[model samples]
Target: MKIKSFEIFDYESAVTFWKSIEGVTLNESDTKGSISSFLFRNPGLSFVAKDNNEIVGTILCGHNGRAAQIYHLAVSNSHRGQGLGKELVDLSLSKLVEANIPRCNIFVYSNNCVGNKFWLKNGWDDPTTWKVLQKQLDV
Candidate 1:
């Protein structure tokens, strides 16, 4: 398998991959156009892992010019034990570091047991003192 930076052409395959994952949440905000816009705004911070040109894993990394965040990190069921997730994280974080980003954060759904476990196992701390409250806004 090969790991590389995400490209526009990989968008459909990445979306398909995410849809197959058990805990991934997809909504109107994840449309092709929105994803394309995100890629345009945060070049080089996202990645995909491929096996013979088929997308197998993906990670979307970005920042708000203050803090870095990682989203949609998933590995195909067939490729989970081989460290693709770690590689994706390392590569994206390297890019952030190059851009002088001080820290990176990831959010896992409360009901996504495997995902939560994966993050904790990979050294991501979950602070009990903090809550991830969000307010949906209209555009």
Candidate 2:
């Protein structure tokens, strides 16, 4: 298994991996193209983990050169419990550090027990630094 940054070639594999989630309600499959386009226009900021030529996990890292946001972490079902998710996170941070990014953050839904536990176990804590505000956009 090898963990590597995102490539234009990995888009289809990434989509397949994402589409397998049966429990979560994500946007329909139509967004795959937009997602790939976003990453293609902004490289070195996201990653895809593959094993035996299949995408097993993915991570999206946002950038400002000072801090980065880790989001959209997804690991294929069969690949769970193999540390691929953690490896994806580590690789993103490693790349950010190499580029001189000083801080990073990831926002997981508070109700997601496993995600909360994972972040806690990984030493993610910065309550005062994050704020949640929203506006109702007229539809």
Candidate 3:
């Protein structure tokens, strides 16, 4: 499999891959329009792993000026253990470094044991000093 920068045209395959991943969350905010906007804003930070024209893995990354954030890091069931996830993350981190972003973070659901384990195994430390909070806003 080859890792490549994500393109707007990969949306369908990416969405299908995300749907197949057990821990991936596809919310109302993750529509095609939202994804297009996100890609427009954070070009070259996200990536996809493709094998024989099929998207086998994906990682969405972007920075918020001060800190970088990773979203929807996933690998196909048949493609796990191949280090694709780490490769994608490393690529994103390199991009962040080039942009002078100081740090990076990813949100993992408490129930996503697999994701949590992957993050920890990849040397990501969880900060116990802070809590994550969010509120829905009406637009």
Candidate 4:
């Protein structure tokens, strides 16, 4: 397995895989919007994983001038538990370090028990570092 930056040619396939994730709540609009912005504005941190010829995972890492964040880390269902997630994180963080950046953050969906535990077990948790909030929209 290897992680590399995504190509726009992958848009259709990536969106198909992403939208099928059970708890990810992603749609084409979200991917199109966030991904296009990231591509033009912050290309370095975004990545994808390939298992030989297939794209099995993707991650989008971001950095402000002061801190870094990893978002939208997803592995295709068949490829889970093979350590691809950890590999992706390590790769992304390495890029951040090369840029002379420190202090990183990642948003794991609160309801995703597997992701929460994985981060905790990896010693990536700092309780005081992040706070979660929700803003209800008038629908």
Candidate 5:
């Protein structure tokens, strides 16, 4: 398997892979145009793992001038248990470090047992003192 920078060309396969995962939710922000803009803005931060020219994993990472955020980290079921997820994360974090970003965060649904377990086992903490709130704005 080889890891490569994510481009808009990779979107279709990446989205398909994401949709196949149980915990990943697709929304307006994940549209092709939005993801294209994101990749343009963040550049080298996102990545895809391709094996034999097929997308097997992906990580979408970006920073808002302060802290970095990771989204849509998914690996093909066949590729799990091979540390591909960690490799993708480590690569993103390394880029963030190079850019001087201080911290990184990810959102995992409370009901996503598999995802929650992965994050916990990987040393990600759910801060008891903080809660995430959101409001969808009409465009």
Candidate 6:
């Protein structure tokens, strides 16, 4: 398996891989055009893992001026136990560090047991004092 930067050409395979995973949620922001714009805004932070040229894992990472956010981290079921997820995360975090981002955040659904477990086990702290609130704006 080889890990590499995520190019727009990798979108289809990455989306397919993400759709096959249980805990990942896809939304309007996930469209190819949106992703392309995201890549443009924050280059070299997102990545994919491939096995024999087939995309097996992905992580979409970006940052606002203040903090980094990670999204859509998924690995094929067959590739789950091999540390691909952690590797993807580490790569993104390293990029953030280089960019001088002070903190990183990821959103996992409260009900996504596997995802929550993975994050916790990987030393990500879940702070009880904060709640994520959102409002969908009509674009």
Best lDDT among the predictions, by candidate number: 5
For each candidate in the order shown, give its overall lDDT on alpha carbons.
Answer: 0.90, 0.73, 0.92, 0.77, 0.93, 0.93
lDDT of prediction 4:
0.77
Give the alpha carbon lDDT tens digit for every residue of 10-129 in model 2: 767666776675432344322667566667655787888778988777887767667788766888778877778788888888878888889998867767666677678777885976
TM-score of each: 0.94, 0.76, 0.97, 0.82, 0.97, 0.97
For model 6, the run of ten residues with the poorest summed lDDT: 11-20
What TM-score should be assigned to candidate 1?
0.94
Model 6, which residues run further than 4 Å from truth?
none
What C-alpha RMSD separates each model from the true structure? 1.1, 3.3, 0.8, 2.8, 0.7, 0.8
Per-residue alpha-carbon lDDT of model 4 for 24-78, expressed as tens digits? Answer: 5663435566577766666677788888867788887778768888877788889
Q: Return the top candidate by TM-score.
A: 5
Model 1 ranges with Cα > 4 A deviation: none
Using TM-score as the yardstick, the better of models 2 and 4 is 4
Tell me the spans in candidate 2 whose CA falls farther than 4 Å from its real position: 22-37, 40-42, 126-129, 135-139
lDDT of 2 at 87: 81
Q: Identify the runs in model 4 with alpha carbons over 4 angstroms from their true place.
A: 27-29, 126-130, 134-139
lDDT of 3 by residue, 1-139 (tens): 7899988899989999999998999986688888888888999999999999999999999888999899999999899998988999999999999999999999999899999999999999989999899988775
lDDT of 2 at 83: 79
Clashing pairs in 2: none
| Error in Å for residue 36 of model 1 | 1.2
Per-structure clash totals for the candidates: 0, 0, 0, 0, 0, 0
Q: After aligning candidate 5 to the native by TM-score, how far in Å is the CA of 53 from where it should be?
A: 1.1
Model 6: clashing residue pairs?
A: none
